[model samples]
Target: MPVQFIKDPNQVGDAINESNTKPVVIHYWNPLMGEESPFLSLFHDADENLGPNVSLYVVDSGFINPPHDPQELPLTALYVDGKEKQSVPFNVDQVRDLIFSAV
Candidate 1:
């Protein structure tokens, strides 16, 4: 399946819990901005490299009209597996690797 755009935190939690067998990539964003933001682009690129088994959950950051686009501002990527979580600066190659590894 492709990346899923989820707007609610409760839904995100449910989805994550339901998909414990699969790796989940939650693409958080400001709803008002739609997919025009840079984060979406990065997520899209990363999604292209992932296999069907990997799932995505788009969590809305609750910023309807963000002061600045994530693309314009620096962003980071987070990985969560069980209780372990790690975050790092967003990068093309790194994202690619993450997706590939998940698959």
Candidate 2:
């Protein structure tokens, strides 16, 4: 799967609901970080590496519709069967390990 851009995180029910069928990994990014944002590339790599059992959602805090937490930018949420199983730390290897472990 490709990196899915979450345009409106405030209205993320549909996205979260989609996770019910497969695991969803959410990456909240800070727009100010821009192209240099490390996670942007990391997510791309992860999306390519992750198998069909999983999907990745890249939600830019700048484009968040409303009702979402801005403080959560730069965080990662790993969900399975529509429920968040873990809040991953900011580390490439750690994130990868967590995903593999969950699936």
Candidate 3:
């Protein structure tokens, strides 16, 4: 599963809407994430395991639209059926759990 890098909110919305076929796990991050970039590797680790049941979108900060705050550097949003299901802060186990659960 390739992690998508969305630019603006419109792209993000499109990605989330397309997720109607499968759950979407989008991570909104910025350069400030620094060492935390390695933390996101967990998603890649989970990628191949999830197969086609999930879609991963890793968007940069300032591209967050409604329901997501721009000030939040690293926010994770879970979308199902083209709707925002859950949003949370960056966390390793938590995000991995969210993806597995969606699967």
- The best candidate by TM-score is 3
Which scores higher on lDDT, 1 or 3?
Answer: 3
Q: Candidate 3 deviates by what RMSD?
A: 1.9
Q: List the residue pairs that clash in candidate 1.
A: none
lDDT of 1: 0.52
Ranking the candidates on TM-score from highest down gives: 3, 2, 1
Cα-lDDT of candidate 3: 0.76
Candidate 2 per-residue lDDT, tens place, 45-89, comes to: 766677576777777655432334566556677777777777765
Clashing pairs in 3: none
- Deviation (Å) of 32 in candidate 1: 7.1
> Against the hidden reference, what TM-scores do the models get?
0.58, 0.75, 0.85
Cα lDDT tens digits for candidate 3, 1-103: 6877776767887888877888998887775656345546777877878877799888764467576567775777789999988877767777777777777
lDDT per residue, candidate 1, 7-102, as tens digits?
655675666564466666554456566544456665666667665666755556542112335553233333445321333334656655555566
